[model samples]
Target: MKVTEAAAQLGVSPRRVRALIADGRIRAHRVGVGWEIDGLAPSKERRALSVRSWLMLGRAVRSRALVGLSGHDRMRTAERIRRLRESDRPSRLLADWRPADAPAELYLDSLTARADRADDDYIRAALQRGPEYLRSRFDLAEVVASERAIRGESREELAERASVSARLVKNIESSQPLTSPGEVRRVLRALDIEPTALPDMVLS
Candidate 1:
């Protein structure tokens, strides 16, 4: 497909497609004199939205407070919008983006309970505790917080990297009695950090 056609099919603009091609998000091939799409679309069917973008769109779609978006269409919409030029896209949707106010303990507790109830050994043990599962179970708050302290990554950076906020990070960090386990894993995963490097923390 021509860049223009590809853009239309993706519900984005020609320039947006071109930029994505340049960024290597959407693969393209050189034809006679123009670029042609190399595949049906990018390898990933849908791009995850930044937490900020999600909040903005949620605001426009309704009134009063709302929780996070669920399911696939939201994923597709986020992918389409992310590839578009920011200025050329729709009006700014989010007010001032922050993380959802879900209590970190609640999700972590649920995950722990499930792990305890499961009878399997390795799978149950890994489920009982692992970086990916912990992140999902805890709504990714702890990971966000540690990044803030270590790297000073903003809400925007965290959103881009893992789709959450500084407030969520701070909350998780301050979640007294310290539900630090989940975040410990989250921080390592988010920052591409290796566990062996943290001998002090690990030994302690």
Candidate 2:
């Protein structure tokens, strides 16, 4: 079942269910594209300490133990805690598929352009992820740009051939991701790239 179903059974949000999975508070088995979410059984009480709660505890501990620290150290510690709390704001991953059992190491180190980090390398590394994580973070724009360069063609040249504006080509190369499937296919054809040649990293 999906995280939503498991959350429903456990009277929590899908986010909470994912949190439990990420923190290893619940036992979930990977099954193809989904998980066998039996861990959210009614008998379990999922009161795991979330990241936010952990930060809260840190703040409490800091406040209580402030007597021994120097003014400078106290300021630094307080600032660090504050920054961590701020950065811990809700994050949304821009990918087609994210697995419930993604490794904590990879998830934390990579998976950027998420939250406030612009970690393109992390995104690229994540392309080699397991079946449960199907999203490639693979940018078509990057491929198109690379191909155009190899063929010694400028954006304007490719645009003329593709019958689209150079500005559109530049947009495709930039951060604003291309969304139209038809446009994507057309661009691939212009670059002599096959749209069907996508990475086969789906959930096994």
> Judged by TM-score, which candidate is best?
2
lDDT of 2 by residue, 1-204 (tens): 777776655544566667678877667878886666755433333232344433332332333222333345444433332222222122222221223343344344234234235343443333221212212324444555544543546789998898887886786666344455555556667865655443332232
Taken over the whole model, the C-alpha lDDT of each candidate is 0.42, 0.47
Model 2 residue 75 CA deviation in Å: 49
Residue 180 of model 2, lDDT score: 52
lDDT of 1 by residue, 52-88 (tens): 5544434322221112433454443334323321212
Model 2 lDDT-worst window of ten: 128-137
Runs in model 1 lying further than 4 Å from the true structure: 42-53, 56-204
In terms of lDDT, the best-performing candidate is 2
Using alpha carbons, what is the TM-score of model 1?
A: 0.28
Please give the lDDT score at residue 81 for candidate 2.
29
The local distance difference test score of model 2 is: 0.47
lDDT of 2 at 193: 61
